[model samples]
Target: MTKKGDQRQAEELDPRKQTILKAVVDDYVETAEPVGSESLLQRYPLGVKPATVRNEMATISDMGYLHQPHTSAGRAPTHRGYRYYVDRLAEPMNEDEARQIARRLAKTVESQPEMVTATLRMLSGITRYAAVATTARDQSLKLLKCVVTPLTRGRALMMCAFDNGSVDSHVVDLGSALSAQQMRRLNASIAKLVEGQQAAEVVALKLSLPVVEDRFLQDAIARTLRAAQSSARVATRGELYYEGILKMMEHVEFQRSLESLEQVLGALQDKHRVYDAMEQTPENELSVMVGEENPVPELQNCSMVVARYKAGKREGGVIGVVGPARMRYSETLPLVQQMARSLSGVLAKLIEE
Candidate 1:
């Protein structure tokens, strides 16, 4: 079946089915227990007989939206059911609800760097699911200022400052010593060559510079530029917080899926994976992945919600959340989006300062 067909089939539940589905999902989400028709009818007014509800639950289970943990136990919504409910049945966040989330996010973070931590905490606290926030490997770097500092007779230090107020230093060996005045001149010249350029661009610019016949300064400048460029290309990752891990363990599905999640989290430490994921993201949009939709196997059983946020007009990063596939999309989507927006606002202000 086509993707839409799968979604539609899941959501094609009738009113009674929807009512029961919602009840099961809600009760399970709250109590982490299998929900029986009688318990559901008693807990929430469904305006239907228990036998009818039972029959409908049977159909829902047959449709792959609900599952029976045992032969006689009540039904619980499966991942398919959760996906269907999220896509069609769950109530969209209203303006008041969105505003409340915005207010809550605003109160937690005072600076840009703090936003990642605040966002993870907020998501975990609000959703009672494990929340994760990661800054893309590529997002943490930018050109600020590049300067060549002489370390000794034949060694020099290439220092580059990023707009994020981070300074990176790399050592370069010179072929020969030069006077302080000559070194100063070379520093100014190299700064002019690549002060504001991106790390990759700086490397290209260095390679294309006209070859000078003067061997000493030529070698020094070449080595200095190479060091500076290498420093710029270095990826620095911001903190990734995994909140409500205990809550995640509370869910049977999550416990079963923890091995996959651990693999994904372990792979996240590989800068390339995080960078590839970030690069694959379309600009100025929020990306959602629901079970099997994620490219990584470790995330196949989880839903990933990611959004890119700018620190200023030109600088930015990404924030994301990872949780069980049965996550509350209605609530998590808006929460993740709002956190990204709020983080961007705070980051922009910090950049201005």
Candidate 2:
């Protein structure tokens, strides 16, 4: 049978077998222990004899959905079992719950990067899983304004505001203070060099030092330009923000095998790998990749629930939750789906203002 046909077969399981499989999965997810027929019957209304339940479980295990870790032990859901179970879940976030969560995230963050960081932190906090997100600022967005604010201790702050509602700023050590007249001149010259230019253009621009020859002002301008260019490259590639790695470690799956945890964390630490994984979910869609479905070798033993959000007509970003295959799909799935929609709404409003 084709893959879809196989999934259909799993879905079309007899009602009794389906009930047994669901009970095993739910019990294993909660207790992290293989579930025997007696244990399942005690907790769930299987409405079948002990012998019948054990026979059905054995049949289910033969179908490759459940596996006996030891010869005489109870069964647990395999990766395929998780896939089948997650595919059948249709839970949606409650309307009031969505409103409360969206209201909490409605407070505007200062910039695109700040918004991504804030979203990821909230996602991790809620799900107790590692969360990751990408920032989706376009590389071709023009620089709208450049502001230089003088600070004490031979320092000044330079902020570059882009047309797409993103801001990049850096603080520089001027090595000397600039008079108001000199600061004004520096601002004008800097603006002329970069205002209305695309981020990539500014990054690649060959600077012709401005007319005023104050050495300190010139050096500060050079530092600011370099910082802006660096920021542009990071923004263009969709800079990644992640949180809650420590929280994820509390799970039984990770606590049992530190090496396995390290391997997954190592893969996540690679920006390219994370971006590639996040890109698998198309724009405005939700994806649930269970263990072994993930392309990254290190992540093959992990599960990911991802959704993409659009900030503009074409530019988009991804947010995701990563955890073990036994993750609470009933809870995590709706949370991820709702958070992604809420984030997109917040970004849309931010761009409007």
**Which prediction has the highest lDDT against the true structure?**
2
Alpha carbon lDDT at 69, candidate 1:
90
TM for every model, in the order presented, reads: 0.60, 0.69
TM-score of 2: 0.69
Ten-residue stretch with the least lDDT total in model 1:
1-10
Tens digits of lDDT, candidate 1, 20-70: 888888788666678998899889989989899889989889888999998
Extract clashing residue pairs from model 1. none
- Model 2: lDDT equals 0.79
What lDDT score goes with residue 225 in model 2? 69
Q: Give the least accurate 10-residue stretch of model 2, judged by summed lDDT.
A: 1-10
Q: State the lDDT at 60 in candidate 2.
A: 84
Q: Give lDDT per model, in order.
A: 0.69, 0.79
Candidate 2 ranges with C-alpha deviation above 4 Å: 1-11, 137-236, 312-314
TM accuracy, model 1: 0.60
